[model samples]
Target chain A: MDLATAGLKTTDHDGIIRIDFIERNILDEANIQLIGEGLNHVVDAMDEPKLVICFENVEHLSSAALGVLITASNRVGSKGGQLRLSDINEQILEVFRITRLDQMFQIYDTSAEAMSAFS
Target chain B: MAESPGHHDERRDSDSSRSGVVVLHDVRTELDSLQRAVVDGIRHAGYDEASTFAVRLALEEAVANAFRHGNGEDPEKVVTVEFKISDEKVWIAVEDEGCGFDPDAVPDPTEEANLEIPSGRGIMLMRAYMTDVSIVAPGNRVEMVFRPAG
Candidate 1:
């Protein structure tokens, strides 16, 4: 699959940007760049009270990808927003489990569920 | 087989019964999903626990290194991974078609300045885990071997 076809989008609601990423295969700099760039766009606007990044369709995630997620989460958290994830598949979740990262990030089963929590 | 432990000898006999390699391509988007296929292909051939883990760790490190460093954000580079399992060990090779780097020149991560960094650990991890590790032909090839213990 092409890197960009991974599905990255964001929406602004009530001054909060909700970034969604759908990735497959090995997530590296190229794919994470999509997430980074999208988040940066929202961060630049600085109009959001909170931000959430929802990962969907991502099957396998590498440490490199995790690094990017952590970086994005830190950036959002520093700006008074939160970087959250939802719809994380089982295979991808195994990596998080192995690394004990499940406790480090807020995860949800659906984007609506995550957004509702923010609301 | 002649000098191995009782169960291990039998295991070796069983292992020799099936041995081969699996080739996969275009499944880059589903690496975890493909892992099962790759792992199963090796274990089914009768590699032991330690050997299997060694091969798996090496493959993970190499493929990841290729995806991040060699491919360099290009999905079209076509990272190819192949593995061969035997009674005594497993050999895994990951091939990437990108500009190469000098492996010998990499700064030791154990050094104080690089200890906290994430970028240079893959190769070190592979070397630490695999029984034999080598970079071939301008870094385009990585061959690792996991020898069975006793």
Candidate 2:
């Protein structure tokens, strides 16, 4: 996906799609909308898609960003696909833990770990 | 969960030497400058990364809540943002044009049943990040403060 259009770098490793955020801060309202749509497109493109959202480059994100992730996870799960999150920084991880999203999502430390976990 | 305990209604006498109040009709157009006004002041006051993250998240959520739920997504209605940044803490309050609701009536997003719901987590995150987060009643206005650990 185009970086500005999606704020993401999506690559296929075998059949698993690993998506990386190109923007350091994912807090803007307009950009977050683009990202939500882009992620939905990726999830809808494949049958039982296994996706990895790696936050290795993201420095900050607001609650709106988290909402998009939950939306993507729900959409993919309904289609029998799987989603994993990886490389989230401590600050962002705290946001997840506080909201108990850490319990709701499959979080891994690395992209490879997430891919492997996708059965 | 609800808010930081016990200190909800007590506003600080004076914690910071600098402050600003910004009123905007469309949050989409104003969020960047609004962010800079608050974040730059916090940085200038020498707060750490964690503090900055906490303040920024709370600020964004509060402003978005004012824009969306409070104003009902109407661009013509203004959102007023007031901020004070000091060496000890950053205090911000965002007020909307519409009538308010009870903050306590909002459901907890972290509960097992509500976990899958995407939208209700804004207030939860604000309460989590801010040292103190409270809604000034009639509920259209939220006041937040984040003090860096010593």
Best by DockQ: 2
Question: Local error of candidate 2 at A44, Å?
Answer: 0.8
Candidate models: Cα lDDT each? 0.61, 0.83
List candidate 1 segments past 4 Å from native.
A1-6, A26-30, A47-49, B1-60, B66-82, B85-90, B94-150
* Residue lDDT tens for model 1, B31-100: 4544555467567777765555556655777887776677774755566665666656667777776787
Off by over 4 Å in 2: A1-4, B1-16
The lDDT of model 2 is 0.83
Q: Give a tens-digit lDDT track for model 2, residues B21-50.
A: 677666666786778667777887788878
DockQ of each: 0.08, 0.68
Q: What local lDDT score does residue A49 receive in model 2, on the 0 to 100 scale?
A: 84
Worst 10-residue lDDT window, candidate 1 chain A: A1-10
In terms of lDDT, which candidate is strongest?
2
Q: Model 1: DockQ against the native?
A: 0.08
